[model samples]
Target: MKIIAKNKVAYYDYEILETFEAGISLMGWEVKSIRANKVNLKNSFAYFKDLELYWSNAHISLYMAVKGDEQRTRKLLMHKSELKKIHFKKTTNRLTLIPLSLYWKQGKIKLELALAKGKTKYDKRQSEKAKEEKRKIEKMLKNYS
Candidate 1:
C-alpha cells in the first residue's frame, strides 16, 4: 500500500494494541487533495455514532481547483464484525480509536486505525530511556566491530 499521510503523534501518545485497515468514503475533490498529499491525520480519531463509524478532525485541504466545503467529516467503511470489535474494546477495555495513517491500497483510500491506551508521563520517560540505552548499545557494538 502507498501511504499518503501518517499521524506520528499517535505512536508517541498511546500504546497501540491492535490495528485494522478500513476503506474511506471521500468526495472527488478530497480524493484529489489526498493524491496531492494534502491530508493530515495527526489529530484525527474514529467514533461510532448511530451504528455508523466516522472519522473526525482529519483535514483534507481544498483542491483550490475545486470549490466547496473543505472540512467535512469523512465516513469509514468497515465490516459489521469489525465495528463490533472496536466498540467492545472501547467500552470494556477503555481503549481509544486513533487514526494512525492514510494510504492507497489498490487505488482506494484506506485508513489504519489502532486500538490504543494512553501512556502516562512516567511511561513516556521510561520508554525514552530504554530507546537511548538501546541506541548506545548499538553504537558501542558498531564501534567495536
Candidate 2:
C-alpha cells in the first residue's frame, strides 16, 4: 500500500488500542488532490452519527484545476458489523477514533483508523525519554562500529 498522508502527532498524543481499514467517500476533485499529496490528517477524527461514521477536520486541499470545499466532512464506508463493533468499544472503553493514515489500496483510497486513548503529560514525557534513550543507544553502537 502506498501511504499518502499520515497524522504524525496522533502517535505521540494517543495510545492506540485497535486499528481498522475504512473506505473514504471522496469527490473526484478530492481524490485528485489526494493523488497530488495535498492532504492533511492533522486534527482529523471520526465520529458516529445516526449509526454511520463520518470524518471531520481532515483537510484535502482543492485541486488546482477543480473547485470544491477543502474541509468537507467525508463519510467512511464500513460493514455494519464493523461499525457496531467500533461503537461498542468506543462507548464502553471511552476511547476515541482517530484517522491514522490515508493510503491507496486496490486503486481506491482507504483510511487507517485507530481506536486510542489520550496520553497524559507524564506518559508523553516517558515516551520522549524512551525515544531519547533509544537514539543514544543507536548512536553509541554506530560509533563502536
Candidate 3:
C-alpha cells in the first residue's frame, strides 16, 4: 500500500480504539489532485447520516482548472453490515470516527478511519511523559553498551 497523507494531530489528540477501511467517492479531478499530492487529512472526520457515511473537512486541493470547494463533504463506501456495527459502536460508546490515513490499495483510494476517544489535557501530558521516559531509558541503555 502506498500512503498518501496521514492525520498527525489525530494521533496526538485521540486514543484509537479500532480501525476500519473504506473507499472514498471522488470526482475525476479530485482524484487527480490527490495524486498530485495536494490532499490533507489532518482535520478530517467521518459521520453517519441517513444510515450512510460521509466524510468532511478533508481537503483535496482543486485541480488547477476546476473551481470547487476543497473541503466539501464526500461519501465513504463501506459494507452495510460494517456500517451498522460502526454506527452502533460510535453511539453506544460515545466514540468518534476520524480518518487516520489515506492510501492506495490495489489501484483504489482507501481511507483508514479510527474509532477514537478524545484525550483530556492530563492524558496528553501523561503520554508525553511516558514517551520522554522511554526515550531516556533507550539513551541510557545505548550509552551503557
Candidate 1, 65-118: lDDT as tens digits: 677666678889999998987898888999999999899998899999999999
Candidate 1 vs candidate 3: the lDDT winner is 3
The sequence of per-residue lDDT tens digits that candidate 2 reaches over residues 1-145 is 9999999999999999999999998898998889999999999999999989999999999887677778999999999999999999999999999999999999999999999999999999999999999999999999999
Q: List the residue pairs that clash in candidate 1.
A: none
Query: Rank by lDDT, descending?
Result: 3, 2, 1
RMSD of each: 1.0, 1.1, 0.6
TM-score of each: 0.96, 0.95, 0.98
TM-score of 2: 0.95
Clashing pairs in 3: none
Per-residue lDDT for 9 in model 1?
93
Candidate 2 residue spans exceeding 4 A from truth: none
Which lDDT tens digits does candidate 3 get at residues 1-145?
A: 9999999999899999999999999999999998998999987899999999999999999998899999999999999999999999999999999999999999999999999999999999999999999999999999999
Candidate number achieving the greatest TM-score relative to the actual structure: 3
